[model samples]
Target: MKKAYISLLLVLVLFSCTKTNKKVDITIPKLTNNPSWDVVCTNRKPLLSFYISRGGIGKRTYIVNLDTEPEFNSPNFIEYKNIEELDKFIVQKRVEKPLVDKIRYYFRAKAIDSEGNESKWGYTRFSLDTDYNKNFMNLTRAKVQNVRVSTGENPKNLIDYDDPGQVSFWQAAPPGPIKPWAIFDLGKPTIISRIWMLANINRDNGWLVDFVWEKSLDGKNFEEIIDAKILNNDTFRNVIDITPVSARYLRLKINHFRGVAPHLNCVIFYTPGKPKVPTPPRGRYVLLVGDQMNGGTFTQLAPYIETLDLDLKTLTVPHYEISLDMLNSILII
Candidate 1:
């Protein structure tokens, strides 16, 4: 009985020693590739590749986090079983929230082993360059050299509307028999794609006005590009996208104001290529005359006027009557 009791004690001691000798894997995986100074486009999806120091250690998955702030261990961290899964995650993020220009993206990655032990977070960063503005940079800025108004409280106030600053505004007087219109000379012939206007009706007064944008290769013969009605509740910045048109002069005609004069803050014209030819007003011309002058008359005449386009004002008078024989002889009328 004493020998049996001694043998049982030895067996217990050997079992305790064997359990204590077992090894636990607490090794943290090291990052092999840490990217720096990587530039990516705002419109494109960037692929991030990383390497782990020990791939054979039963690494089951990776935990990836991308955010403007560095919170690696947060609940929002994305998990991936492999590199292909990580790529899919990037594609999904891009579809949800597109990366914006001039912004930095932070990326953190960690490896999780089969034993559920997570490695230390590895970090990298990438930035979006301003190269996305290449399309805008190629276009030229159209300058407003001259401003003419049919009727206004202060004609000189029209100059303030050329800049985009909203501090000052140009106010036109109440429309009379002749509609209040503001004509602008862009100083040169340009191929324009877009026009932007920042305007608002006078405060405390709700009013609406039909704003017409007319473009002219010559100062005299104008063609309408945009005919839009603007209300007091409309946005301050109004953008008009039009097919590219070559023009030297642009006109903003206001169809009779409702309550008071409409306030205009800025007018911007975007054109492609460099300015080579200067467009100046020589005189007005009579392209076509109907029984009465109205908006419908101009819209109907746009197709004909576009065909017989001219760079210089050929007419010396506001109204001119030419016979069929004389019209055929004139190159531009």
Candidate 2:
């Protein structure tokens, strides 16, 4: 009887140990955007998406939390519990709350299965600032003090004006074995956010093909910021938004193009700051509107323009400063 009792006790102890050692198999959620190193710098809410491994056929629950601190100890921290039909949710556009400006907020999310198994939390952080959203000025017009090119006539024409309406063009004279290149001096070390190019009006096929945009601080040493190649020329403007870089000199090296000579109409660079108010128009009666990408609105207003005998001028923001020629026109906000 004593031996049998001891055997039963041993069996119970082994079962208890095994049960305690068993691990819960839960699928942890993955945060797609707003990685740890990247600080989202806009007031506009960013899309949040998540992925789950071994997504079962059944429904799942997602728990998202946000806090101002990394430890997530704030009493004002927000939590969202959503039951999703799919095992994964992606690119969610809305957020429950608005983040305060200048505050760095931490984000975390976890997943729970139908079986009540919970997953570990994934984490990220983001911040908000109006400085990131403000319309920046064209530095090529305001900052570029000098222009130089390896093989071109009147390189100053590239920086002479930011207007696409200009007739002057700096052309890469052909028959020379050397590739065409142009350098722009920004006067000082300035942070460049975007590069805008106007298609050459001289030739229909004179669009830029393969080129590299490089930057230099001292004007002696340089590094490439953009390598532009593929193009879909739907408009007269080609704008390239790059990661903000600080440099005193910007160089454009033209590798190849469609026309006999590489013709450059205008090249403008923009940096983050308040954009200058456009020069007001004088003595002309034209209705001005901001850039309309698809021209659907313009098509609808064609009848109105014809009836009013009004000249229509469409100006792209920051690229073309806002100025209206008044026929006592009402500027649409």
lDDT of each: 0.55, 0.64
RMSD of 1: 21.2
CA shift of 312, model 1, Å: 48
Summarize candidate 1's per-residue lDDT along 1-333 as a digit string, tens digits.
999999999999999999776554433333324333333445534545565434323634666666655564544334444432234222112213444557666676666666666666766656666575443233445667888888665544545532233446567676567877778888888778777665552342313346677889779998877533344433344667677888889887776444566667666676765322223244643344332211123234545554575532322211112234334444343
Clashing pairs in 2: none
lDDT of 2 by residue, 187-270 (tens): 999988888787654345666677778899998898988543334442335667888888999988777677687777778787
lDDT of 1 at 299: 36
**Residue clash pairs of candidate 1:** none
Best by lDDT: 2
Tell me the deviation in Å of residue 169 in model 1: 1.7
The alpha-carbon RMSD values of the candidates against the true structure, listed in the order shown, are 21.2, 13.7
TM-score of each: 0.38, 0.41
Q: Could you tell me how far off, in angstroms, the CA of residue 321 lies in candidate 2 after the best superposition?
A: 4.9
